[model samples]
Target: MKLVVRRSVCFQGHQIPDQEAACQQSYGPDLEYRDLMRVTAIVICAALAGCQAVPGEGPLASAINEDAGRSPAEIGRVNAAVFDIVDVDNHTARLVSDYVSTALKRRFGIGGGPGRAVIGIGDQLKVTIFEAGADGLFSTNDSKQATIDVVVQPDGTAAIPYVGTVRFAGRTLEQARQEILASLKSKAVEPDVIIGMGDTPSRSVTVAGAVNRSAQIPLNLSGEQITDVIAKAGGPTSQPYESYVTLVRGKKTGTALLKSIVENPSENIYVQPGDQIFVTRDPRTFTLLGAVKSNSRIEFGANDLNLLEAVALGRGGNDETVNAKGYFLFRYEDPEVVLGLLGQRRFDELARKGMQPDKDGRYPIVYRFDMSHADSLLVGQTFPVKSRDVIYASRHPAVDLTKFLRVIGAPVGIAVQGAAISNNLSD
Candidate 1:
């Protein structure tokens, strides 16, 4: 039988202040307090083995630097949008109901298929009284005046005069008319009752949590596919959709993948009645603050992001102006802690590949890849990206912030003194 041990160390490569480094070194590597380097060596060895000899994706499970081959990247950049959530408390519902009503009017008779289906307690129904003649059963009143209120009965069915106690609560108008005809055949001699639904019913699906537009998606049975529902409520606003659309059906919640459903036809599932679709945004993003083209938070694609891809999103590096050699990554120091929760096989492979820090402190626990390697097409394909890794491209040594401030400060001071003297003379 083999035994396994776990370890962690917080490594910061930025050379400490002279005062702190001298103080820490004087404490000596003896007392238990000096655990940073002692513990780091074990993780360093794990990380080295990973960089040099690891084969396959299994070993470097949490190594964010691994490449995903050439297939996914070639797809190029598509729409990188995010969704926001909306609640159906009371006031918003009315606005949605009115909008859906207009949409239904335009959609009528355009498609041979059934019109949109909507659900709400107070939807209206168009009931026309037609007297049979040799020609046809013409409407007694204008189609406008014949519209009637759909009332709920004690038994749950809606009430109508000629078609008393017709069951229309849960059923669509089409389904309700079929039930009404079945009831009338038993009483009148071959009665002719024509029914049509007025306006799209005002039913809603609640969109809650981290999306861009989280509002109720007005439903019509005519509408199908999860995308149709998302489109109805405004699509995601950010790049590369993160999180997922969750369908909450009572106590049971099921997940609908955003990419697979959008990219693949087989995965698109239909929205059911009383279903709540929620889109959640991801908090895991690379924070690139200094000396970059677009200094903003870049949220990585959930599955396919590596070191090179992260830089590419920021329009790559402007090495001609800034120093590319100073580029580095910052993340939670202990990669093993996060890997352990992912899978056991993954953890062992990461350890064996030296992706975990070495038992003898040398390089960082994480790999430091050179962006220059991307010049070669083969090497670029070999690199992979992981979620939440922060990439920072440091300023060139020749250009220093401290020096720039000192050079500018003298001129501004001289100008200020001259202005003060001139102002005193004017006064």
Candidate 2:
């Protein structure tokens, strides 16, 4: 006795209609429903497992997954000073001003003059004596004049005829002339003297490194500036923006960009004797990574390199896969500056915990630029990219979703095929 059966299925709450006309060989209706439900449940479970296994798979899987556990706010709270690009640029301008002011003060002091030029031993002097009388000691005829070449002695005196050994070292040219005139007043009748520097051997500034010609430039009464000495050495061989000019005067030393020294009058302080001016090609550079068209180290070509220019240097802005809102620039900034930028309450909380910068006097700082906003273009224009900075553009959400879907497609396909095969066999 053959039992007539109809093929019907119920999945979750939805029922499939029965083929009543077909009285096929029986796979018991209750058993078939149980089997279908079991297959459906297995497929759903497999799909869920596949999703769980591939959670980290995506186009941005490598980049975003690394920090998946930390949200933006949580990451910011962990001792990393975060700011918008616009605020960062404004603060950086203040920082540059402070640096310039400090550099000027260090090199030039309160007054911008080069100060007095003191005579020293080993310096040559051209001394001219004039006599009013025809029969005077220095007179050969009616034009009564005598010239003598003198070198400052180690004991700070210069030997002269009838004037004995006079102390002239450590005195200016005018002072030396007065001393010589007083000494000769007792010897020659109505003697007058004029002292001028012939070749200054002891007072010189050394210009070295990256200049076309490195030399020891003499410091004269003209009070030549740093730029003047550098120019005498044939100027800098490297690009001004890429070069750094360091001034070492006695125990004090200061460094600034060559471009800054050229553009800012205060920075072109007078060069003092014994000052060492070094111009080096210490080019500032930043790293471009993540969703940029090209990832590499980019040197700053200008004195002020804004975010837009930096992005362009890295082979144009971010690619299609980038998240416009997730552009980031990482740097090390002064701790005090970071705190000042954060303002009162947040700074107080962080300071209370004794959060200090490292030995380099820098704290880790991160700046976000939301390219999604139209005003961000202007912000990018003003935002400066400092040396050793890292510019990163994060991947878009769609990239992750597409990657996940691609990763799970095979498993899901297999599950669907299995369900279809089970249905066919049951039918």
Candidate 3:
């Protein structure tokens, strides 16, 4: 049986006539037909969706999916820190929406209607006329960009033309308009005023740090967020891999992680005037131990240090006699962070067994060594050092003690002998 279709009229002056209305009114009778129709519609929607490309499935997918490729140098890392156009998509949408809303309110003369009283500032005003055609404050240029300077008196009223001095600063535009029109009945035939933003520069936020650039981002009716501020400053520099950013608002400061704050819309706090955003750099650090002039920490601007380079940085052993021997390198790098040149099989075996080598491997090895040997120098060159590595060097006990006696005891012996001879001559 063919389904009788009728349309019905819903709210807001929309018409749903005969066929549609009849179906709704008799849904009990048309239940099977309606069910079929709903199923058909869902199927059609699914078919359409199947035909369409999914997000990140098309040509642009490659670009979007590509991780900020491995940065080999500090310069490359810094370049990667720039925020892409896609990152600011939400900010763009919000700004457009807010600006459109502001424009609509202004165009429709919707001066915050009654019960929603607007606010006003010093020299601020709201001019309106119940009788119409009596709005006359500045009409010469008729330009919306009118500039008439007036002080907000101690009584909270501003001195204006025709109406003399009237309190308006703290009141909403509508409130000020009504109050002024009431007071102007004796002076002029009509009175109305419109309050607006002043010519003074609005409040802005400043972003600074390991960013490509830094600037003060302005605020319109459409506000911005921390991410927007970071983008404005050219994003965070990858050299430091800013795990989190810090924002200073007056005396108080808050820290936000890049991932958490960006992904969660609720936490994306609206930036305020005078807010300072600092994008931090990755804490650069390298480790040093073993036989070196300075067995301490070394820092880098970038994430890099060669095994030999780090040892050299540590002055590579103290006295000429104590050269680095059987150099041992300890690294805190990821277990999977592979080194291209290093023998992977050997390295992995050593890593898995937690076995470190000594000078001799035939029998129970005596791992300690004297730096005076020439072979130790070559060992120092090959042993690789990594981030946060500890280079431990076992010194030969005999060599250390002998060098110490030469360095200290001999000098004291000569001084004592000379003193005794002088005493004998004096006697």
Model 3, span 128-149: residue lDDT tens: 3333332434333333223445
Per-model TM-score, in order, reads: 0.41, 0.70, 0.32
Name model 3 segments beyond 4 Å from true.
Answer: 1-159, 163-188, 198-202, 237-244, 283-427
Q: Considering TM-score, which of the candidate structures 1 and 3 is the better prediction for this target? A: 1
- Best candidate per TM-score, number? 2
Ordering by lDDT: 2, 1, 3
In order, the Cα lDDT scores of the candidates are: 0.45, 0.67, 0.43
Candidate 3 to truth, TM:
0.32
Q: How far off is residue 85 in model 1, in Å?
A: 39
Model 1 root mean square deviation, Cα atoms:
20.5
Single out the weakest 10-residue window by summed lDDT for candidate 3: 360-369
**What is the lDDT, from 0 to 100, of the residue 228 in candidate 3?**
76
Clashing pairs in 2: none
Measured over all alpha carbons after superposition, the RMSD of each candidate to the real structure, in angstroms, is 20.5, 11.5, 36.9
For model 3, the local distance difference test gives 0.43
